[model samples]
Target: MNGLSGMREENERLEGEVSRLRTELSQAAAGDGGGEKVNELLGEREAIQAKVEAMLDALAEIDPEIAAAVAG
Candidate 1:
């Protein structure tokens, strides 16, 4: 029971972190940074998007019902 609770807490934390990272990536992606800076941020945005996707997949596995509710 304790482990289950811990897992839930960790899942929530990861979800929050993923959300924050996604926002940062979205902002960076939209920004007009010049040249190398733009390319670097775009790369970071791609990495963050991949990570966010993975986290969402994991969350879906954990609570598909919730994911479905949110999606619909």
Candidate 2:
């Protein structure tokens, strides 16, 4: 696949992961889950966020103006 298509797929996967982690975090906060579970969810969210940032950075390398607009 092309660069943008590959990145779009990665972005979608990461966004899905982030959404799932947020749901788990909320459930933990609601007391349906434990401290360890909450911590795990938080870690997963952080990892996904890092990946998204990296992808954005790559996009910036491809087109700084567009990336800046998207980042905003």
Most TM-score-accurate candidate = 2
Candidate 1 per-residue lDDT over residues 42-71, each given as its tens digit = 676577567656655666677878579647
Total clashing pairs in model 2:
0
- What's model 2's overall lDDT? 0.84
Residue-wise lDDT of candidate 2 within 1-21, one digit each (tens)?
369889999889888888888
Misplaced by over 4 Å in model 2 are: none
lDDT minimum window of 10 residues, candidate 2: 25-34
Stretches of candidate 1 exceeding 4 Å from the true structure:
1-33
